[model samples]
Target: TGKKYNSAAANEAEEKINIAIRVIADHVRAVAFAIADGQLPSNGGAGYVIRRILRRAIRYGFTFLETREPFINELVAVLSAQMGDFFPEIKSQQNLVTNVIREEEASFLRRLDQGLQLLDNVIAQTDGKEVAGAKAFELYDTFGFPEDLTALILKEKGLDYNKAEFDAKLKEQKDRSRLANEMTTDDWVILTEGNTESFVGYDQLENTVSITRYRKIDSKKDGVQYQLVLSATPFYPEGGGQVGDRGTLKSINETIEILDTKKENNLILHIANTLPDNVNTSFTATVDADLRDESQSNHTATHLLHQALRSILGTHVEQKGSYVGPSRLRFDFSHFAKVTDEQLQEIESFVNARIQDHLPLIERRDIPFKQAVEEGAMALFGEKYGDSVRAIKFGESMELCGGTHVKNTADIWYFKIVSEGAVAAGIRRIEAITNDAVKAHFAQQEKALEDINGLLKNPQDTLKAVVSLQDENAKLKKQLELLLRDKAKNLKGELATELQEINGVQFLAKQVDLDPTGAKDLAYELGSLGTNLFLVLATADEGKPMLTCYISKELVAEKGLNAGAVVRELGKYIQGGGGGQPFFATAGGKKVEGINDALNAAVEFVTGK
Candidate 1:
């Protein structure tokens, strides 16, 4: 075995190549671990942090290692194998992590290719060695290309960008973000000494309580807000994917409407736009009964849905995330493949079947976590648990949850899956409706079908009618293409006779009564007639200007005539630009009036006039 070992980090290695290896190795862990901790790559907040890190590794591999395909996702397996025992979450979510990284890699690589082309255009348009930061920032803002990566590419070409200008643009963006998300909170005005606040929303919708603490909040988004902590609350604070409860706090003098509720530092804070008239007096903490009932139905339905997915799609299904609200519920779970229409129907039926069974809720409060787990309660990943936990059970579905739920499954009435799709690599999301929402969904769908039927003149079989209509449209489209082809062929014969011998080259430049495609077809047909043929065909299709150039191979080689250069130069007449091979090219513009001007200027290229 004669295998040679080279003293190089990478082929055609540089100092940065060694740095790239370290960067990829280091940044991939941050990204993988972040995803494991229930954060996915997104455009904002903590998600943005992970996304930026992943992009850095991708760019490094793309530029230095010459990696063109998705390789970052492959690294997840190695990472999982190395740190699996220490951090079991990564090992368990290995496939999810891999798929997420792969999708992101492929998506960004496409963006990278687009950015490269845009960067090249910027370089061509620039007056000096320094590229404008505004253009670079546009690439970052519009295409998600990193600015440092932009700088690196420019540096490799013996060029540099304006750093100070880039910094100013970046600062402007950050300033706008700060202004949008700006928030300030005043210290709590303590009405009581100890923290006696607790959630009593499970048993009652209304409770007599005293104000324990209150604070004022100021934010640009919501303007002014107040946070009040009651001695005991019937309002449920936002947690475990369920939105905070909104209700009213009624004192003797006035009723203050709670806008939202949130839990911070183990304190249940009821958010309101205004404070009570008398802070020292008692108030009845009442939860919004209608909203609460709606939320509970969706929450309970979510549990049944989870059980159904695991049962029907194998035990690999796990709760990745969820949202329970008044109108609808969104459930994110771990699954390798897309849930087919058949599977969705099966899952909906499974949940509805449980609802029909009328399973009563069996809740255990303040049980040890180990005991609840040992009792076959499913604990969701990425959810924190203490020594003691509350378990909610309904028939065969049981989970360690603190969210409010229906007293009985029959309260849900019905469950319907509205949509299902992939959210990340191995993660799929299902949006569903229950009770009143399901009713509304059915009404909307029925109305849509009725409208469709009315449009089809009350056709008995609407599906068959639609298929017939599509077939007729397709047939008409084929007939239109054939007519256009016949028209182009006839036009080519007339244009060939009108060709002028410009400097020993067969040249013709004219506005054509055809589409851009037809112009292209006509030009190629004329080019194949003889050698030294240089044709420039201009057209305005439905008020949009387009230019097509076709130069024979003989003319291109003998006279060095480039069709790409011709169209690019001519494109200025129409206030647009484009390029292609030396033999054929195309350009599109917004102004149709410029078509004749572009056709007029085409002869100058051949004549050098």
Candidate 2:
């Protein structure tokens, strides 16, 4: 009875330990959610989080479920469904998650197969000695092969591995990874007991403010810098991907420069090289009015463009990310492929249509989040939202946003897409401009056109002038090709006469004054002359040797000669390599000096002498 009681007690303790471990894993999962909510993962940190979660889930599955197959996808579905309300991004991007996980699993499986093959090859070459598991583990980790798979393969080959050494190497890699990615956060310093950051820039450019708490931080690049907090700031902090506002703050007696404004942990951080000598004194904050207006115009234009894309492309488009600044605005969205030129033209036209309409900007503050969405306001992916939200609306475009916008769309004189390209596999980006930027862009275009017209002697019909020049260029190119073809035909006859007979086989080797394309044509022409023809042609064009080799069907079968292999071998003489069908192959080389050697190698390959 006493022994049974001891066993029961130990069993209960083990159960508790397992429960604690599970709870810790759940908490780690929650930390991932929190980080994701802050949009920290989407830009660059997402890959690390994804790998961490996958490894954790896979390890847990192996320990508890005793299954090696990937289980993270199922777990992700459950977690995403549970947190769908808070983060709709997860729900919307569920397909993306599936694709990423499936690809990772497939990649890992392929690596395992490759590792097994490599280990088998390695063990076969080993001279009756145990292979170090550390070396095996290094291949596993570096190449994403599972260690268990390696062990099983090694066991089948009657080879032992140093398991302890393998574990040590794996642990060392984990330690280095942890040290590199570890981050620490300091406690926040409250400047004021206020909940909201008030912006007076919409109606006014200057405001009176009290000095908030400031701290010095050290970074890798910039040695030391100070971040200041203000009770109320007129300077717009960098948000919505826009660059920060620059201005000056004047106290009763002295002035301090406000270099840039940025946001951290939902708090506005004003970066400055130096602090005011009077730390407790009150000061007036002033924003660069012109910069502020230009930024606001661009911000307003971005909102219109978002609406324009939906109008032109489809309702599926949503803002993935954005940067609104005085100079320009960059917006990212979800799209399978590049926007066609026709679609871009329509999108640009739609945005300009809104600008011409001069719709009034309507901003509704402190609206319920659900109500905002129900009202057809577009919400961005990977953005965290609270119960109350700020909704910005134009005539047809509405979105939950906090960035500054123009009061009226008319203020945005014109909208132009400066650049458009892909940011990722499924994400497309557009950089655009408005107002002054558009004017400047058009001014540059006008100057360029004027210079072109001047060079053309102010041609009355630019289209006619361009067509005439194109016709002349085409004619010249055709004449040059004809001249080269005639020259090659004449040279082919001379080369045919010079063919030497070797061991009852015909051989021809020469440097032809023809391009790679033309040389290949000549070789084929010569091969069709008769059977048992072995041809090697070398040409130097633009200081590079173009080597071509051809063997007739009869000689290829009789001598077991592969022109593909021969060219690959001979190409080394010319510092290049290539392969093709048994009949024909060509190679390019940087070493023009090796053309003769390459031809000689080909002759040696064909004759077998």
Candidate 3:
């Protein structure tokens, strides 16, 4: 690679720098959009994918463009400006996106430095020109330092980190991550042929169906399992956040247990434990009716929760994701802050009022997707839409949905929030339960209230009683602090007596009985009394070691004594590390017994011996 010293020369070179710039721009926009969608760079999950994308672009710039400075952050504004129309969120979240990118850039640079230093250290020990891959993998796993960056730097120094060994390490990590989602599936063996499978679970719980094809699978998580595809089956495949229906397949004397129903491509696969005896015989596919009923209620409640969230949190709120189970439903939406208690109460009331209204479910199928949208039906952002779509409506709440729902809102019984929290930046999640689960929630609440009342000796007003007890606790804490301060004042005298002179420097080291802040106050008071003083205080705090260092302003200028350096050096004895300004510093550590050693070390700092 040639280094172009001038701007015009760089453009004249063209391919290297220009291609690097284009790749960086394209990849940075992808990362920025992901962050705007509330998935930021993290060490795990989807966030890790975003991190790798950003780092790859940064590496390209470093290698091809000769970028000594971080130019990735410069691309964020360009990305936001160009892609802001369709994804206006990039512009709305520009500040966060840019700051997050800048932080990632700084972090990557720091880890790169550490990796290079590690390489230099390894090279110094062995007189060889090659570095071990284990050391490189250590940097990658522990510091998130990229192997590519390590290899590039090593090449520039005429050294190399073992690629085969590094690849093995990489493969190990990838395989471990993939194991949880792995399945060994055999090709489908057709027993009987027919058109694509059709679902009859929405209209009926049982149907006589013919087998189209079946396959066997083996997974580490679940042992040997068989997946059967049937024509005109009554098992609802999992989709749109609804759990798969479970039941049994029976034909005469044989019964095969249906474990789960899931759709792959245009095929609905019924998972079962064993295969039937006669492959050509027709079987009755039955769905668990009770489970389907509970799931339907929760699915309807999810729609209600979506509407309530949009109404309360402005019209900008949109569904990011959702999960519907028999006992609970979790709805993820786009929002910046947490929902308050009052807002939650209002949301619950809104859903219950709609339930009490008993709005009938209006369903329409075989409608154009755009036509449904034009007719005021809400569409999910990331869902793939076909030419024809299904619309589900409950009075004012209408959405493009295909999941089974209750015939009436009253079937929901009641809605209750289980928890609310942030899933990512600009995304919040609300977990809730409907119908029978709500009864369990209420019983748990009642038991909690009863326990609190009994703890307070059956107070007439439990809340007031608890508040009064809190006030009493605050008063007691204040009194205890006053006594500690008085005790510290008396101890200050003994600490002063321990002051000694070494080489015309007033040096003191002693253990005290004050909290960290109180101990610092005592050091400051003592410093005001004299000049050319070096003071160190060691105190034990709840089985942990803590120390403070203070140097007189004149001593810092004349003797060049640094409090931060001294405390950090002494902190090693206590198994801790810290730093501060030259005049004062503090540290905390795990070994309380090292407090005495830390104070003695400070004394050694003054005396040559």
Return the TM-score for each candidate structure.
0.91, 0.69, 0.77
By lDDT, who's the top model here? 1
lDDT of each: 0.89, 0.74, 0.84
lDDT of 2 by residue, 244-342 (tens): 888888887888888888887776777777778877788898988788889989888888888888777776676777888888989887665689888
Better of 1 and 2 by lDDT: 1
lDDT of 3 by residue, 56-172 (tens): 887776678766566677777887778788788888878767766776776776666666665654554445777888778877887776777777788888988777887898899
lDDT of 2: 0.74
Q: Which ten residues in a row have the lowest lDDT in candidate 2?
A: 1-10
Which runs of model 3 end up more than 4 angstroms from their true locations? Answer: 1-6, 9-51, 54-172, 178-183, 208-211, 250-257, 272-284, 500-515, 522-540, 545-583, 589-609
lDDT of 3 at 234: 84
Candidate 1 local lDDT, residue 524:
79
Cα lDDT, model 2, residue 79 = 66
Task: Look at candidate 3 and tell me the lDDT of residue 421.
Answer: 93
